[model samples]
Target: MTTTTSDGVATTRPAGQQPDPAHGPGTATRPRGRRAALRPGSHLFLVLTAAYFMLPVWWLVVAATKSNTALFDGAHGSMWFDDDVSFVDNLVQLSTRSDGIFWRWMGNSLFYAVTSGVGATVLAVLAGYGFAVYRFRGRNLAFSILLGAVMVPPTALVIPTFVMLANAGLTDTRWAVVLPSLLNPLGVYLMRVYIQDSIPPELLEAARVDGAGELRIFARVVLPLLRPAVVTVLLLTMVAAWNNYFLPLAMLNDPDLLPITVGLGQWQRLSSVGSGGEQVWNLVVTGALVSVVPLVVAFLCLQRYWRGGLTMGGVK
Candidate 1:
């Protein structure tokens, strides 16, 4: 069939068919799009990934509430809480163990993490900005060294670092742990990349034209733009410092100076040895749970910055 409009343009269609104004070809396509959007394997993978990460945390929470006997007993499932609620009792025991030294370990961890995190952030920003913005002698060689440093396993350098610290008479001191954490090559590299991509050179030129010095330009202009990268380096260095084990173990023999990682290993050993008929399994479990709380809280508090860092820092 054919029809003519006022403009005398002819159209053809099936004898009894008319076009629906609202639902054209899209009516058929919308259903296909909806079907294509829902992938069973993708949903399954997401569910499994979430469970894989969450199950250990759930076990920790459950295990913290149980007594050592219940924790080891086959009667209760590891995924759920037993009838006994011993979190408060475990806290008391953990606090009093070794004359309140566990709290001291916690304090030491906080100090090291915060101090090294700040120092690493500062140094990384300065070095990375310089690498990205400046032209200097041996610039490529220096950055190549940094990238090579990133590839070297930190564990491989622990012995050398310990020897250097010992020679300087800084072994067994808080500086032993903190000083090593300040030189994060990965942080410098990340900052350099972030600055190169996100910051415009014209802005720096304008700042320089207005009589702003390099330090002033960095402190005022570039730093604000690098907030995401700075936060990223801060969190990475802090987590590394907090969870550090081998360096402190190699450097310090003093129990009072030990971070939670080494200190908890001591408790774990004591738990296994059953020295003086005292079992520390409960204390170790509780302490592990307690130790994780700070990092979790930190992540929650600064998660917005973390998310922004992922977007801006090319981490995603």
Candidate 2:
């Protein structure tokens, strides 16, 4: 009845040659070969989704290898190249373009992503911890307000935010992007739920009896326990901040202040008009590929931290 998957998860398979169609509609199963445990349709959807996502990426990979001319050659398969490979040349060009300003934009993005991620994570954790641990007056009311904020779309506030930032004379600066992204209402809510379920009250009480200050207790006792939720919130916030397009587009008029997202848009617009022509499509494709790398790396590298018993401390 028990079969181990590649990742070592033990799954239960029923004893039958034919699938139990009555078990559920569109959900089928069989006990044959590698298909013994795997539901018949499990892999079909997964493979389809994988192909759907990877197609454009495959195209980008192939396209990045070709010159602009090969890109426009209609006879060539969209996923294949028939011309000179210039991935290296394009990368070199990308690196050296505009007095090496691409690197500057990259650094700015890293700074914004890292700083805002850290700040947002900390605020989320503390706020969530407070919501979980403290029962002050209006706690539910305050949490309800946070839940409401989560429902409110961020784009709806763009103009009002712009007006406020303009009034404060903070527009066209890195702070303009960094400041707004630091507050994640959903992240705060998520942290609260995570802390409530994962953090141990007894542990906090034990620390308090031992004369641990709130901040000290958090640093030495709670943080290590909340690592998974912390990683989850941090990664989510980082991706959000890094991919933020509209906020930056509205606040930053100066090209120097633009993040890669906005900067890439500029390239897309410019490429449409000049020698880039149809070839500029590759830049957009290539840029998209490059932009996704950091997020993938972050997820892979930090996934371990996000896997532990994040609710161990919060449960009764």
Candidate 3:
């Protein structure tokens, strides 16, 4: 049916039909103009956040290109490069400096990180599985205490840990750093929560009925299922251990015992008080750049684990 108004514009409707106000069927929906545009605050926030993080990294890269003389000569902006990029040269020097001690620090960092990540993951898995499956005395209370301990800054424990190590004669040794980092309260808590939500008790009971011992059940059944959570605890604890500074700083004294974090810090301090009493800015910047590479590599290599772990950790 068709109707013509007094102004002579015609409207049409078939019998038993109604017009929908939203849109014509053939047209794609469009936004209501400015409201759909990026909000100024969000855009500004993203830009600021990007700059805040990337600025220092940019400066590190650019500064590696310039000689130390150009740093404070007002030659260019902090993030801008001078005519020559001595970055490769600096990298070579960094490798050979002090009998290639940089590689030793790098190896030490790896040893500490891998050792800690593995230890933390295994401990977390056991503690978490125990918390989820067992009914023991003071279980909840113990868990609550453990979770509470996570809130206490790890840094606050450094001095006490150092003192303990000193008495135990572990000071200035690899054990001083690695032993302390082995157990992470946060990782344990996370594993507990993950296990409680992800693994059903019935599965373990069934596994037991099928003639599996505790360790066998854990290895053959639970480990595969818990891989994602294990990865999460491993990655987080690994990053924590890799980026750790204060504990190692407080625990170990010998330069040979230093991890990259402490070693780079040593270089930074040396930058300020060379034989000539002036900073070696080039070494500082180059060392900073090189030190971050392993961290980047670790993340890049295991990024898939991180992504999958997060996805699975949310399972109920």
Better of 1 and 3 by TM-score: 1
Error of 1 at 198 (Å): 2.0
Name the lDDT value of residue 34 in candidate 2.
57
- Candidate 3 per-residue lDDT over residues 1-316, each given as its tens digit: 2346458975432211122223432122435585578699998999999999888888887888767777766356776887666778787877888898888998889889899889988988899888887899999899889878878988888898888989999999999888889868877776776666567789999999999998899888887877766776788878888889998888888888798889988777766754454576777778788778767777677665564444433232
lDDT of 2 by residue, 98-163 (tens): 776676777778888899999998999899988998899999999999988888999998889999
Candidates arranged by TM-score, highest first: 1, 3, 2
Report the C-alpha lDDT of model 1 over 1-316, residue by residue, as the tens digit.
2346458975432211123323433244466666778788999999999999999898888888888888888356888888878889889988998899999999999999999999998999899999999999999999999998888998888899999999999999999998988889988887887788668899999999999999999999998877756777788788888988888889888999999999999888877753654677888889999999988998877765554444433332
Best by lDDT: 1
Candidate 3 global Cα RMSD: 13.0
Per-residue lDDT of 218 in model 3: 84
Q: Over 4 Å off in model 3, which ranges?
A: 1-41, 273-278, 300-316
Pick the TM-score winner. 1
Order by lDDT, highest first: 1, 3, 2
